[model samples]
Target: MIDSVKTPRSTYRQEQADATRVRIADAAQRLFARDGYSATAMEGIAREAGVGTRTVYAVFGAKREILSVICERWLERAGARELAREVLDTVDPVERLRRSAGWLTTLYSTDFDVARVLDAAVDEDAETRELLAAKLRGRNRVMDQMISSVEPELSVPLAEAQSMFRAFAAVGVYGALVVDAGWTPARFESWLADALVHQLMSASAVPDPAHP
Candidate 1:
């Protein structure tokens, strides 16, 4: 006869705590989007989250931390890091740039609300601005690497190619097209694919724009 093993009480408690944190973060995300970060009070977050104010403080030390949690969750949903890997793995120069375009569209499409909220709060607080800047730097670093993977095949210099890639990934471009002009995400992706393939790759490599 063998004895059965059971999960530890502390592990269960940690899981419960993590779930509570997520709930608080999600509630805070909605509130922050509706009310600018400075305007959002901790009590409101606790009330919206259905948790005690103390619990909110215990889980997240400050309101900015909640923003950080929300950004982390958004990145997971957007698959930002994972998709960069896909671009690096792609062998064809055209397909790789196209995947990079798709990655940018996915970044904004999955959580444009958060992006808008962050932009709105950027000037509201110093801490918030730095936090957003750090995230932007991290993402841009990955984009640089993805473009570097195809440097040998690029028609332009590496610096020029990277600059073009970063420009296309700008949130402003996406907002102007999809949010303002009401272009669908798919259309933006298609346009970006054509633009990158034509401008970055050699003429021999530029094929008929693959419409997906």
Candidate 2:
């Protein structure tokens, strides 16, 4: 008979620490969204989370670090890693763009407030600006990967492809259409899919505009 391995259980202390971390992060996100990043403080987060300020500081060394954690948590919750894998694994260029649009729509819809808050703060704070710059760089890297994946089917030059990808798949575009213009998430996704296919794909690869 083969022996089965048992999963290790979390200790009480570990569980308590995990709960406190969650509380701090949740409080921070709420405050950041409501008050903007510059106006929110670690002390306020601690008070909102019902923990000591020292505990918040000990768990997250700085306010920026907490913001970083918030971003990470949002990405995880948005299923970004899994979506990236799905996009990469897809071989069809049109399908890849569609998947990418769906992923972006879901991401923006889930964290629009956080993105708005960060954008508002980035202009005023050096640290926030750096963080925003890093995020844009990461987004560009993903776009580069996506462009490379669909290179064989592209009608445009790589630079144009990059530009088209950024413009069509931007979160702000989604926000404008879905949040401001009152389009449904499904409508935004369909429009993005059609727009990307028309802009980047070859004539042969472009799906019927009316069908998307």
Candidate 3:
């Protein structure tokens, strides 16, 4: 029946609210990237979104919360959490390692402005630092799980393998290779895949490092 499929009034209202929050978060992210995070204010975000300042305050309450939403949206665009799951789910050792590289490459290429903003945010108050730290811890946990999936097949110890994963996934490598040196995203992905395969996989079990 048509009535059975009708949208609830409450659900519609909630969806509208969520959409407004995303708009504010996205507008704030642009400002944070253009101006430093400390320099970008809630008023600027409201002005950019063409919304009242009160709406932003009502939705996110603080700039830090808006940043948190931006980070989440960025990750969603990167397919990062899903890719991490795929890496762990992969049965082949070579394939698993290669998929991890894909995940890292995807993240670095997916609007790296969030990383730039977070770097600037580190100089902020302790609460903001804690938020960043917590986010890093969550990411590391996922990385550890991905590496652990192929641990016995790795050339290095578990801790060492995880450390390698962390190092190669750093924004510095992406910045240097892709942003500074001007390598294309595909080229950077290829380089990282090869580097990771050589560094982490045993010679006998290794396959071509090209991502699928």
Q: Give the TM-score of candidate 2.
A: 0.86
Give the CA lDDT, 0 to 100, for residue 69 in model 2: 79
Worst 10 residues of 2 by lDDT: 116-125
Q: Candidate 1's residue-wise lDDT over 10-110, tens digit each?
A: 99999999999999999999999888787999999999999999999999988989988898999999988888888888988778888888988898899
Off by over 4 Å in 2: 1-10, 124-127, 207-212
Best by TM-score: 3
Clash pairs, candidate 2, are none
Residue 19, candidate 2: alpha-carbon lDDT:
88
Each prediction's TM-score versus the true structure: 0.87, 0.86, 0.88
lDDT of 3 by residue, 1-212 (tens): 55558898999999999889888988998899999899999999999998999999999988898989899999999888878877778888887888888887788789888987876687888888899998889888988888888888889999999998899888778888898999998998888888988998887787545842
**Model 2 residue 27 CA deviation in Å:** 0.7
Per-residue C-alpha lDDT of model 2 across residues 43-142, encoded as one tens digit per residue: 9999999999999999988888888878888888888778888898997788997887787778777788766765566654677679778877876787
lDDT of 3: 0.86
Candidate 3 local Cα displacement, residue 204, angstroms = 2.4
Q: Is candidate 1 or candidate 3 better by lDDT?
A: 1
Candidates' C-alpha lDDT: 0.87, 0.82, 0.86
Where does the lowest 10-residue lDDT sum fall in candidate 3? 203-212
